[model samples]
Target chain A: MINQIRADMYRLTHSWGFYITLGLVVAYSFLITKSKSVGGIMVNGNQDALTRLSRENWTALDGIRGTTMSSSVLMYVLIGLFVIIIGYEFSQQTYKNTLISGISRFQFITAKYVMLLISILITIAAYFATVIAVSLILGRHVGTSWAHLMSTTGITTIAVAFFISIVFSIAILTLIVTNSVVISSILIVIFPLAVATIHIFADWNWLKYIDFFGVSNDVSLGKLTISQFGPYLLTCAIILVVCIGVSLLTIREKEL
Target chain B: MTETILDFNNVSKKFGRFQALDSVSFEIKRGDVYGLIGENGAGKTTIMKLITKLSPLRHGSISLFGETTGHYQQALKRTGAMIESPAAFGNLTVDQNLKVIAKQNGIQSKNAIDDAISFVGLEKKRKTKAKHLSLGQRQRLGLAFAILPHPDFLILDEPINGLDPSGIIEIRKLLYKLNHERQTTILISSHILSELYQVSTKFGFIHHGKFIKQLTKAELDKEKQSGIRLEVNDVAKAAEVLDNAKIKPFSVSNNHSIFVQTNQLDTGKLSQLLIMNGVELNGMTKQEGSLEQYYTTLLKQTDEGEK
Candidate 1:
């Protein structure tokens, strides 16, 4: 089990894709915070309005609403990252050899999840650190405090990013099922986009809380007591259970 | 008692209407280099999966190294397998990939990883990204990963499937070394019977999800001894008549040809016998059965089953 976990991490950690994703997340967070600067030169058109937007340059929870467009864009990027991450394993035919090493399917699935979680946590940490470091260097630390990093509220904000992890888990499940990346990625994109859009026009407010995005909203607000919270989490749980079950079944049935 | 390493008793698997493995049973003794050979879409892989317990056996039981499925961890702890194309992480370096498998097997000491790398002959290419490695190298890397735990039983399906001639020879040599030196009981499957014949001590012919026959090298050789070949008209009926006449042969070649060993039957009496049975013995020759002939016969039987 330990060896399999080690192998799982090794399988992922050495890639150009791994480094690139981590780098981009860190760079983007810096950009997001750097854009909040009031001094020196401004690049984008809405700088004046952006500076007024938030005085705190960067905090763990600050990216919750990240640049409106960024919210959707980041989601797209996260989905793509996950789909490719797990999808690449099957595409390259590596899973066939791995399973026969007497490593159980349960171990395979668990190790992958553990590795993906670690990678996501590492990347987001780097992202947030970049934001904080850049803020200090530019003297735009304004309303930010080191307390933000250690706060329960700050930690809870991580729950917002949990949806991306769920997407990744689903991506792995997709890999196990379809065993094809293009199809899995397409389904990932289509289902989310389709569901989110369909929710947009629904008359019932509760229906809006039926996607991963809704669960992220619940976590970001730091309130399970929030009205939209219950159904949102319920939906995420439902999806997770169904996906995990499907993944195990598929792996069991498919010939290695 | 020669220790039995792997035992599949009455195993069967079905996918809806299709049965991929039907009541397959076999056993591999310790120190046996067993070869499981079949055509494409045969149940060789299914057997491998069932041994690993990757796919649950629908109607039978599998035991590895004296331990049944529930206790297979012990059997598996010292086992290595490569059922299909090597499953590896493409982004990681070859060394890193081995390291991962080694670590999974609880070989965390850096020396163990380094040793495995050298074992697979990937030392110089240790840092090379996995995707950059050629097909043969990837296969070797997979081999290294599987054997890292120093298994007593190894199940390899198409271990040399896509390799060049040299790669195939190298792998055959490695398999021989493992079986002889390490005393590993290996069950390997390959489409090319000749490639496997050199190293295999035992052979199992699987067709359309059935292990129709299993024989040791001596048994197979004895079966081939005194073989005779025949070419005549009404091939099917002639073959049937010969079958009914109790003229057991090791193998039958294409186009009504049959191979019987040199001493199995008296040639004069055999030709006279078939002729007397209304089977035109157009061309009769004494012969020996090769591995290819055995494979072809089994494949023909499988084709007949499908029809």
Candidate 2:
């Protein structure tokens, strides 16, 4: 299992697309920190407001929200990276080579999940590094107490982790079902939009509970109460398990 | 008794109501270069896929290296296959692709990858990406992947699909060497019967998802031997003349023709003897059955039977 993960890491890291996406994420995060844009939309079109936003006390919680909000639009970059990484196996028929090399289908799926975990960790580390560098260069001090810092950073980390897990699971499920990079990518984009639209326009009050984007929005902004957080994480976990379960079942029975 | 490397018993597969393989069964023993011959959509790839567990065994069982395919990871650990076209990451170099497979198989030695690349004569092009490779080079890379692990059994589907004559010879020699030196049991499928004829020790003919026939090299050679074909005026008289001359033709047809299954017979003497006996010889030709002819005849027979 470790060997399989190592092999996937070798392939994933060697890809130029991986580096391109990482560069885009870092560059986009840097721009957002400098400009103080929220959700990629500039506020008030006022230069002073941007300056005040950048000059505010940069607590770890603020850093998390800023990084998450700035990087949200670039989620498509993550989707494309995985499309190349996972979808290429089916398109190129290299999955058969792996299976024929004696790796079980379960091992194959686990390796992919591990690869995604490592990628997420790396991205999170880079995001925090950029946040720290920008905050220090701007001469902002950490004003929050240790207890406050711990609670805020912990909650923020859990929220981001859950959000990433949901996205990663969806990306995997899409790739497994479509097995084509183009179609999977299209579905990845269309799925979120469709879900968000239904949740917004539908008259049913229950639609809001199942809205993935709305839950992610609450988590990223640190607006969710403890009660809401538990259910949100539970929903994300259920979706992750279902996606993996369906993928394993489909792959086990799928013809090469 | 020789050990069986691969065994398929009553394997059947279907894709959306179209039967890809129907109760197909065969066994490949150790050191046997089993050639699976068939046309397009004849379930050759399907069988290979089933052995490697690329496709699930829906109706029956497949055993590899004496273990049921239900434990595919264990069964396939000692097996290698290159099904359909060569599968590789186009972005990775040939060397990188080989190393990736080696690492996946948990090989600690780098020499294994190097040896396989050199064996396939890809040393110079090892740094080249798979997408940059020609069709023959890609096929060789696929072969390198299969043999890099030093598997006990190898299954190849259309390994020589697109290759120049020299490329074909190179791959054939490489496979033969692997078999001779390592006693690697191979189940290879190909449409080129002549090329397969040169390497395969055992042959299985599949048509319309069925195993039409399976034979050893000796059996196929016997069917492919050259014979004397004589068309004379009188069937009984020609048989008598040949019998009197001690030729004892292999078979006589209703159209006054005799088939003597021997290339060593003195045709000149037989013709003189026939004319001397007043047997009017209209035509005589030496016919040798080829693998292609045999395969075509087998498919034709199967088609006629279906009709």
Candidate 3:
């Protein structure tokens, strides 16, 4: 197991795609945090809109962690990054040679997931750092209670929300469903946009809660609750479980 | 003579309607250089995938080093291969590629990495990017990767597929050296039978994913279906002489020369009888079999299916 993990990480890490992704994200984080042009989002600043964003996340490092765990966190970089790591294996024809390396499909699949997980944690952490640094610099200049700006519950809520969101779950799903990177990336990205539209215009408000795009408004991260299955929350739960189930099933049976 | 390094029983793999391998069976003993040959779509790669557990067996069991399919890591880890392409990150150097593979297989020491590099004659190109290397160089790097862990059961599918002549020679030399020095049992395939013929001690001719025949060099050399050659004045008269003499299974080429099937025929007797029958007699001698001829014969037999 250790051997397989070592090999898988080596293969993924040595890839130019992996490093290029980290570099790009790091660059993005730096730019997003430092850029002075927040010509600003059209805010109805409706207590509801602020409530939604506020409930989704809280950060000590406003410039870094806040942006790090932003609802778009997974979508911005991880979608492309995960595809390069996992989806490329089957699409690029590299997996043909890799299979004969004397490793089983299960080990390979699990190792790949682990690598993605570690990548997510590390990159998000970097993004969080930028937020924190900016928050500190601005807090000193602007005179705000940076410490009281967030509750522990707020941070944990954001982490778990991102975890349960479509990024990791759908990335693994696409790994099994399509097996090809380019197709998977397009499908994964496009499905959410279409769903987001449905959630806005169609009667499928049920779907926002289902799995593709239901995010909580005021869930406490530090106060992690044993999820009470509401319709929206239930949809999220079912889809997340089903997607992971499908991923494992395909990995177990699908041809390498 | 040694332990069974690999075995397959009635393995069949199907890709939708097209069957890649059909009921293939073979056993490879330890330390043997086993050569596999077949035309395109003959299922050579499929069988290699089965043995290495790259792809699961569809209808049969494949055991490596005596372990069954379900728990193949130990057995598979003992095996190595360069199935299709020797692909790697375009930016990684040859040594880096070897090290990564070595580490992946649980080999931590740098000495093993260096040893693998030297084994493929790529020691000089260690610092060169694998993508920058020529096709032959990539082939060498692949060979180096396969052997880096010192695996006992090695499978190389068309390992020399894209090599220049010099590259082919170097790979062949490396294979020969491996078999001699490390006694690693190898199963390598090539559509060009001649390439496989060089280093393989035994040959298995496969067609449409079925095992046609397994022949040793000694058996091929001795039986001599391609045994004798003769120059005859009259091809028809020579045919009649051969018929009358009950010398069966000889081929008469367009040049009017006959290739007799066995060494037991008396060339002098054949010539005299043809001359007596008012046929011209020119010359006669023995023939050695080429790998291509043997392969064609085996494939033809499989095509005929004992009919």
Candidate 4:
């Protein structure tokens, strides 16, 4: 399993898709940070107004909001990672090269899952670091101390990671079952928005658990009380476990 | 007796409504180049897939190196395969593509990778992406990938499908080297029967997902009938003359040649008879049967028996 992971890491890092996706992540990070800090700072007719806009300060709250908002968008953007890492193997038939080498199906899937989580975390970290740096440079008054900023951002980031991890696991399962990148991509893009839209008209508490973007809103705002948070996480955990189980079963005896 | 490198016992596979393989059983022994022969969709690729576990082996049993437990990952570790077409990451360079394979197999020696690259004559294209390679080069790359692990057993399906004439000879020589020097047992299948005939020590003929026959090369040679071959100026005239004389079971093989399958064939008398009949026999020699004839005859017998 470790050997599989090591080989996968080499393949991932060498892939052009990895670099292109990472570049997009960095570019998106800059855009999100700039917008969150320089809201309505577009040049007006007056020179004085433009000068004053440049002097305005950004707060730690601005950085946290930018990072959390980007995380929600990042979930959609990172769909390509799964396509490259897992779907490409099936489409290109490259997985046969590894599987025929005496590696078990369980180890192959488990190694890929591990790589997916690690790559996602790396991109999330990059987004977080970029947002903080950009905000610090723009902010004249961050806070009396950096403690509150660090702790809040840290907690929010963890929540967002947990949310995104569950969502990505669902995407992996979809890719595995369908084995078509186009179908997986289309379904992944539609699933969240569809759930969120349905939850609005239906107005069911249970419906909110799977409405990924809606859950992200609550998570970003730190609005979940212990009572609400427990069930929400429990539901997501169940979905995650089911996805993993189904993913394994789908490929267990597949001809390819 | 030689050790068995691979054994298949009553293996069967079905894809939905179609049965791909039905209780096919065969074995490849150590130091043997076992050529798998069949028409298209005759369970050749299916058998390779089952051996490599590309397709699930649900109905029967397959054992490698005497191990039959749980898909035999440990036993498979000593084997290598390139099935159907070569599977490669088109975006990766030849070296990088092989590095992924090497890493997965836990081969730490850089020399092994270099040697495989040179062995397949792809050293010049090591830095080129797989997509940029010609079909022949890609085929060689697949062969290199299979042999890189220095496997105890190798499974190749149509390894010469894309090669030029010279390329075919090179691969044949490489197979001979692997079998002679390394004693690597091989299970290979190809549509080109003559090429297969040159390399294989043993043969297995499959038809309609069943093993029709299995024999060694010497046994096949003995099984093929010997006859008189005449190259004539006019094949039709020679055939007419032979028919008039009631020559038993002679076939005009081509535009200029006729073959007579007779145990009592007298080359001198046959040549003189053709010339005297004004058929103009240009040459006469004894001929052994070809792989094409053997396979065709076998298929005809099998089909007739089924009826």
On DockQ, the stronger of 1 and 4 is 4
lDDT of 4 by residue, A81-164 (tens): 877778788888988888888898888877877778888777776776777777777763564367766666666666666666
Query: For residues A160-206, what per-residue lDDT tens digits would candidate 3 score against the true structure?
Result: 33553445666678767776676666665665456655656666535
lDDT of 3 by residue, B201-289 (tens): 88887877678878776776554365778787778878877888788888887566988887776667766777788877677777667
**Model 3 docking grade:** acceptable
* DockQ of structure 3: 0.43
| Residue A233's lDDT in candidate 4 | 84
TM-score of chain B of each: 0.80, 0.87, 0.88, 0.87
Error of 3 at A98 (Å): 4.1
Worst 10-residue lDDT window for candidate 2 chain A reads: A41-50
DockQ (CA atoms), all models: 0.42, 0.75, 0.43, 0.71
On residues A1-256, what C-alpha lDDT tens digit does candidate 2 reach at each position? 7888878888877888878877877777677666665563211122442354577755545665566544446556677566655778877888888888788778788788767767766665566567657766776655466566556555554555456646777778777877767776776566655665665566666545555445544554556788866766677778878988888998888877
- What are the per-residue Cα lDDT tens digits for candidate 4 across B14-73? 888788888888888999999999999999999998888888778999989999846589
Best by DockQ: 2
State which candidate, 2 or 3, has the greater lDDT.
2
How far residue A229's Cα lies from its native spot in candidate 3, in Å, is 10
Q: TM-score rank, highest first?
A: 2, 4, 3, 1
Question: What is the overall TM-score of model 4 with all chains considered together?
Answer: 0.88
Clashes of each: 19, 0, 12, 0
